[model samples]
Target: MSTTSTPDNLELATTAREMADQAPAGSLEKAVAGSVAITCATTRTYQEAIDVLGGIQPVEVRRPAIEFLERLAVAAR
Candidate 1:
C-alpha cells in the first residue's frame, strides 16, 4: 500500500494541533472538544493518504472521522 498526504489535510492537522494546545485544562468538555478536533484532523490525514494508495482497505477508512465526530458531538451534549 502507498500513502500520500494532501495540503488540506496538513492544514487541518495544523489547526487541530493549535486547538489542542489552546484547550482549557481539567474540564471534560474541553478535553472532548480537543480530542474530537484532533481525531478529525488525524483521520483526514490518514484517509487522504490511504485514498492515494488506490487499493482495498479496511472499513474503518470509510467512517473514522464521522464516527469520532459523532462521539464528540454526543459528549458535548
Candidate 2:
C-alpha cells in the first residue's frame, strides 16, 4: 500500500505513535483488549458497548471505539 504524508495523515500518525508509547508491548495485538475486557467484565454486550461508547466519548473517540468493537465482534464470529 502507498501512503502520502498529508498533514492529516501525519498528525494521525504522530498521535497514534504517542498513544502506542503509553501502551505496553503487544498492545497492537490487544488494541481492542480494553473494550473487550470492559464489556466482558461488566454486563454490557458488544452491541450495547458500541452504542454506549458514543454517548460517553467525543465523536472522534467514539467512532474508532465503535469501529474497534465492530471489528472485534466480526473476529469473534
* Clashes per model (N, Cα, C within 3 A): 0, 0
Which regions of candidate 2 fall more than 4 Å away from where they truly are? 1-36
TM-score of each: 0.34, 0.46
Q: What is candidate 2's TM-score against the reference?
A: 0.46
Tens digit per residue, CA lDDT, model 1, 1-77: 11242234455445545655776776543454354455546555545433432232333333443443343334333
Compare the candidates by TM-score and give the number of the best one: 2
lDDT, candidate 1, residue 53? 27
C-alpha lDDT of residue 15 in model 2: 39
lDDT value, residue 71 of candidate 2:
48
- TM match of model 1 to true structure: 0.34
What tens-digit string does per-residue lDDT give for candidate 2 at 1-77? 11221223233333334444566876542343354344434433444444566563334455665565554445334
